[model samples]
Target: PLAAREASRVGAHRDAAGHYEVALRYSDALPMEGQAALHEGHAFECHLIGRIDAAMEAQGEARRLWQALGDRLKEGDSLRCLSRFAYLVGDRAAADRFGVQAVELLETAPDSAELAMAYSNLSQLAMLAERLDETLSLGAKAVGLAERLNRPDILCHALNNVGAAGQWLDFAKGRRDLARSLGIALAGNFQEHAARAFTNCACVEMNRLNLNEAEAFLDRGIAYCVENDLATWRDYMRGVQAQLLLRRGLWNEAATIAHDVVDDEATTALVRYPSLVALARLRIRRGDPSAGPVLDEMKRFLDKGMELQRLAPYAAVMAELAWLGQGDRAEALRLIDLAESRSPTRAVVGELATWRQFLSPDSDPGEIDGMAEPHRLLLAGDWRGAAAFWARIDAPFERALALLQGDEAAQREALDIFEGLGARPVAQHVRGLMRQSGVSHIARGPRQATRTNLAGLTQRQMEVLQLIERGFSNKKIAAHLTISPKTVDHHVSAVLEKLEAVSRGEATAAARASGLL
Candidate 1:
């Protein structure tokens, strides 16, 4: 047992698990209390190493032993562990039952870490199940108890759950709580809790469209995980990174990350779900037939749980596919209605509402605070407002979606963006919409060019390419060309795409090699 403690203390979780197993083999020689404690320790070690079954078995043994010893406090704590293990395995019903039982048992016990953990676990479950009011209520109880008990681990755990849940309902309070949780975990060297804090912070920031801040958290969290061999957390953060990349219009890089996670057989569902969503969304945007298999696979995950985290993204894509006349409209609406029934905060509901509008334009998406600015504007029939907001954020895809509802000129601009982003289905849909509106002289896109010469650069694109080659900034290029900065951005993007280059320098090099410069 001492050896196991030392191993865990050093962050050697696999070694710690092995040492705990060795200690458990001779547990018959110890008292009942000692034996139960060893089992609990072994269970935690196993969990850290991603051995869910082993963790559950060990924790069950501990629970039985505590019950036999008439130790309700320890038994309740063991049950809490079992609840978490069940949730990780996608047995939500079993998780809820165990968590409730644990909380009931602990409620009669004295103020303790065991009881605090029970509250925290129940709160976390409530949050994941989209019971926002219950989550905050229970989370507050747990945090208050943990603070009074002066238990950093319990406090950090409670804070993370509450903070993440709070972001949906109260953005400012959520950020403060998450910041506090992160600080306490870091100061105490609680590596796992710290990693979780980093992941949650990044997720919230990404959803809020604060990409730079999200990237910073991901970088630090990934480094910490790598240093500590936290494979589970590392993979989970990588999934968030993939989603972040997708939101930033870097589909190629996003696809690479998402595909890697989806292809790895060893990944846990918690880590795989987000990556699957990212990949499926990307494939849908590109009009790939392969998106069918990806979405089909996602259906299996949806069967596991109906958490907003899972339901929102899947439904959003299905809503888009339905809008494109390639999916079941009724089913998409059903899913969106179900997600809305969860009473999600503004950001999530706002997204669902946007999709709802696409499918059923007359449906009301009631006023929601904290909705992403662009989506709120879009839902309110302020297409120009939404497009301007998306442009300010540099989110071209969403900007295009907003512009698609505008006048003919705006629709043409939207088509240009979709084409540039390689969103073939959306671009084609935009073209169809234009034709239906009796718009004429629609572009057929740029013509193909030979390997030599300017590689099919338009006069404007060639000018942008030249400025890029000369190390001119976008602002400087815009000034020289006497065009709006937005126009300059479009031309710069076109030049890079035409040259098949990933960066300004590479675009210039490709242009020079093709004798276009």
Candidate 2:
């Protein structure tokens, strides 16, 4: 029992499973509670190693044993585990059933830790179902209980669920909660909890368009998972890394990593879908003929019933594919409506508005009044204005999309940016546009040096510059990038010197004006 417990504590899941199995062989000679505990331990190890069938079997036995022993608390714990397992397998109905049962069982239980965990599980289920208000309420209860009980693990789980749900509902609170959870997990040496905290924090950064900070967090997460032999989380972080790469206009690298994730047989549907979406987006952006088939695959996945939390992203991507690839305005509008129905958060609404504009350039601009700057301009039929706005924001892909709707000169500028970023697919599309416009003598030579040459800046320096542009303080940047404040200071100094600016704001403005952003 001690060996099994130690193995499980250190994340040696397979070894723990073996030890638990050996202990279970002598179950008849053990006490009822001991037998139930052995089965529960075996179930957890199996679940960790992706043996879902075995885990379910063991957990069912454990739950039955707990019930026979009249241990409501242990039964509630088993139900919570089952709830998580059902959720992992994409069975929301079963997950809800188990979670509700767990909560009911724990309501009268005196053990604050068990009750806290039960509430946490229910909160996670609520989040997955897109019940944001319910998620926050349940998470608050879980947090209060865990704090009173002094249970760090329950608190971490509650914080993660609430923080993730808050990202779409309340950004500032989400960031604070996720950051606090990360600090607690790190200080407590809770490897799994820390990994989840890192992932949630990265998602928050991505939402804020702080791609560099998101990438840094993902890198740390990947390293931590590898060091601890966490195969599932490693794959999930790789998917997120692919997403960050895609956003940075590194299409080839993004496609390679995304394909690896999609091809991994061990990955769950939840982990695989984002990678698939990234790959499809990359293919479509590059104007690949294969994009149609990928979009079809996404449609099939949607038909299989995705979690409500993922519906908005899936619908947003489909809206783009419908507009750009199929040229079906009606289908695109339907997808946009679907996305808005799912979340209607700022990001989703903005993306939907952009797709609507792309589909119908003559549409009423007033319909998208509260959209983001670039989307608002694009929807208003000011393609050139949108291009300039995105360029000023250092969003090259968006700038290119805006420019694609403009005149020859704008197309030429967009092509230059695309080629400079090594976006071969987008550059090919731009070249085709040039050919169709009867502008034959296209200059395909190496790019000329600009007046504001940012080539002097290293990758790290560029990351620092972006954070600086986002108004992150030196300490905040250091924390986000996982570097010493002293290192951040040096990077900031180098960025200022390379940009030839007197202050951070001046450097940001200079970079934007020079098109070196």
Candidate 3:
């Protein structure tokens, strides 16, 4: 029992679970309190490995034992464990009941660590429900309590919850808090907390379009999960890696990764939902007629009232599939409306707005600027105008879509860009169009540098450099780009490294010399 408890504490979940099962077989020989403690340890290990049914069963037994012994604190801890299990299994109603009961029981208890944990569980529940403000408040309380108690475990969980809440409220502060949480977890050898922090930080970077940084974080996260036998987190990181692949336009690889996640029977619905949508989107972009089934599956999840945070991106992708693949203008409009209603962030709203305009030209999409301008022009039936706008923005995919309606020379140019980006599915679609047109030996036109330049800076890095040259500070640049300052810092570092410069001024000068500014 002690070995099982120690293993669980150190994040050796699989070994802990094994030892727990062995101990449970002889638990009848132990005293009531020992039996209760053993069951609780088993429950926690089971929960860590995503064995929801086993966790709930063990925790229920533990709770019953503790109650029989009149141990309110241990019973409350069991309730908190049950709450987390319920939340993971998507039973938010049950989770809230358990969470509230735990908090109420622990409120008057002298154990600050336990009380902090109760608050952290409540905060996590709030986060899942999209109650960001409540999450922040509860998480702050938990953090304060944990810090006062000097409990590393509770502190790590509280910090992660608070940082995640901040991500939706203020990106700069969120990134900093998440980074600090990761540092603390690592320094304290809290493997589970460190893995979770890595995943959250990578998600932030991914949202900011910092693909390189996101990948780096994901790599570390995946390694940690593998080393510790964290099955659920490993799968979750794989799903995130698939998302990064999709953003990079690696269609074949992305589809494969998403397919694996969706097809795995062991995978939870929370992870499978996004993977299914990603797979469906890739299929639609690849011109596959079979994408309809995938879309239908994703729609079923949406209809079940998934959390708004997940629904936003799912609805946006469904809108695109409806418009582009199914030709269901009405459905497209409805999905876009859903996307807008669920999206809490400006970046997501802008993306959905771009799709909304594509489906309904008469609908005012507000100021047409940035990446969406070309899309709006395309929707207005100004193919040449859209193409020109895309070319100016250096957006090859939009340019390709625009040229699909006209301009064979420009279409070939767009194809070259897709091919260079390893966007196999998109390139294949473009190639089919080229073959149908019987175009050959097209004249080369002036093109912006590909994603990678002679100076080895990515397109995003080049944009950051340009903004820096325009005298924008990191915070201002983050606001301008709708990314986090941490992401801006990453870009600045990359720019400096690639230019072999020691300062921002020197980096800007080097970029200008390389004709990148």
Instruction: Find the candidate with the highest lDDT and give its number.
Output: 1
Off by over 4 Å in 2: 25-28, 286-297, 304-308, 364-373, 380-395, 415-517
Per-candidate Cα lDDT values, in order, are: 0.82, 0.75, 0.73
Scored against the true structure, residue 201 in model 1 reaches a CA lDDT of 94
Candidate 1, after superposition: displacement of residue 419 in Å? 1.7
Please give the TM-score that candidate 1 achieves against the real structure. 0.82
Report the lDDT tens digits of candidate 2 across residue range 240-322.
78777776666556766776676656666656766777867776664545557667766665664555446656666666665
lDDT by residue (tens digit), candidate 3, 327-410: 677866776776666544545455567667656657886544432445556655677897786566454555666776667766
Superposed model 3: Cα runs more than 4 Å off: 9-11, 108-111, 288-293, 325-327, 366-517
Most accurate candidate by TM-score: 1
Candidate 3 minimal-lDDT segment of 10 residues: 443-452
Q: Distance from true position, residue 21, model 3, in Å?
A: 1.1
Q: Rank the candidates by TM-score, best first.
A: 1, 2, 3
Which residue pairs show collisions in model 2?
none
Mark the regions of model 1 whose C-alpha exceeds 4 Å error after superposition: 21-35, 445-517
Pick the winner on TM-score between candidates 1 and 2: 1
